[model samples]
Target: MYDTILVATDGSDSANRAVEQALDLASMFDAELYGISVVDTRRYGDSMLSGSSGVIDDLSDRAEEVLAGLEAQADVGVTTTVRRGRPHEEIERYADTVDADLIVLGNRGLGASGEIGSTAERVVRYIDRPVLTA
Candidate 1:
């Protein structure tokens, strides 16, 4: 029985499916649902590259918007958070901070590669808790 469930989303179709699965799992287990959207800032670094002005800000804004939309769709009471960093690392860190019993994430994301996205692969590699890809 999970006490807390975390879902990492990027507003992609796969991620949305994961969200629904997480919500359903949370509802079934009567667990607290937590949502996170991470703005991948590893490429941006500390200083803005000349051509990438407002790119970080834009990503951050999109992350918040994604979280907001997820919150609206959630049937159970959900706590949503936004973080800036590599998606996999930030997600694991956040899950650890919240003591999540399970992590629900997408098999693929916006990138839509034939294989799983690096974020999901890395998260599975590093996280100690159960991860369900929907």
Candidate 2:
């Protein structure tokens, strides 16, 4: 029932599982698959020191690597994107832009485990589309 499926990844174990799930679903439905990795801008802050710190650059590089890994693991062609902003907001916006029929993401990403990651929780709460958390 899905046409375009958007999967958000953070290179975490759970995110990797989500990628596998999204890939399977996309293949099953013969749908387009899109992968996204967001560099959380909030983590770097807006201060001048933050800009000079190179943490954002590092994060961006990590995001790119995560997307690359996702693409490599997929048997089918995967459209990948890297964005900088709040993870949930960027994911939601990208999903809307792609007109995704399903949004798949990890329930807990690179953050501390025990509960759902804030970004995934927020995406589920704010995004209107169907979200599958792996």
Candidate 3:
């Protein structure tokens, strides 16, 4: 049984799977789903950074939008969070803050498929909480 649940997402397909899985678990256990999306602001100054005025804000907004959609689809108790920073750091911090019984996240991110993302692996190593990957 679980109460509070947190999922780190990036609006990717795998993240969507995590949302669906989290939703199913929440419904089964009557748990509350807390969705989180972190915008890695560090990308702004990186060489790959594209020219943009509101890159950070845009990512935050997009993240919120994606989470909102998931919440709407779940149609149960759901909460959304958007932050700018390293994905693993923000997710770990959120897990601690929420004291989540379970932290559900996609093993793979928006990057390559069939392999777990580095951020997800980092979160698993750094955070002491439970993580269920979809």
- All models: lDDT? 0.90, 0.91, 0.84
TM-score ranking of the models: 2, 1, 3
Model 3 per-residue lDDT tens digits across residues 27-64: 88898888899988775566545556476667778998
lDDT for each residue of candidate 1 in 1-134, tens digit (9 for 90 to 100) = 99999999999998999999998999899999999999877666656644575787788899899989888888899999989888988999999999999999999989777888888898899889899997
Sort by lDDT, best first: 2, 1, 3
Better of 1 and 3 by TM-score: 1
- Structural RMSD, model 2: 1.3
Model 2 lDDT per residue over 17-100, tens place: 999999999999999999999988776567853546487778889999999998888888899999988999999899999999
Model 3, residue 105: distance off in Å is: 0.8
Q: How large is the C-alpha RMSD of every model relative to the true structure?
A: 1.9, 1.3, 2.1
TM-score for every candidate vs. truth?
0.92, 0.94, 0.90
Off by over 4 Å in 2: none
* Top candidate, metric lDDT: 2
Query: Largest TM-score belongs to which candidate?
Result: 2
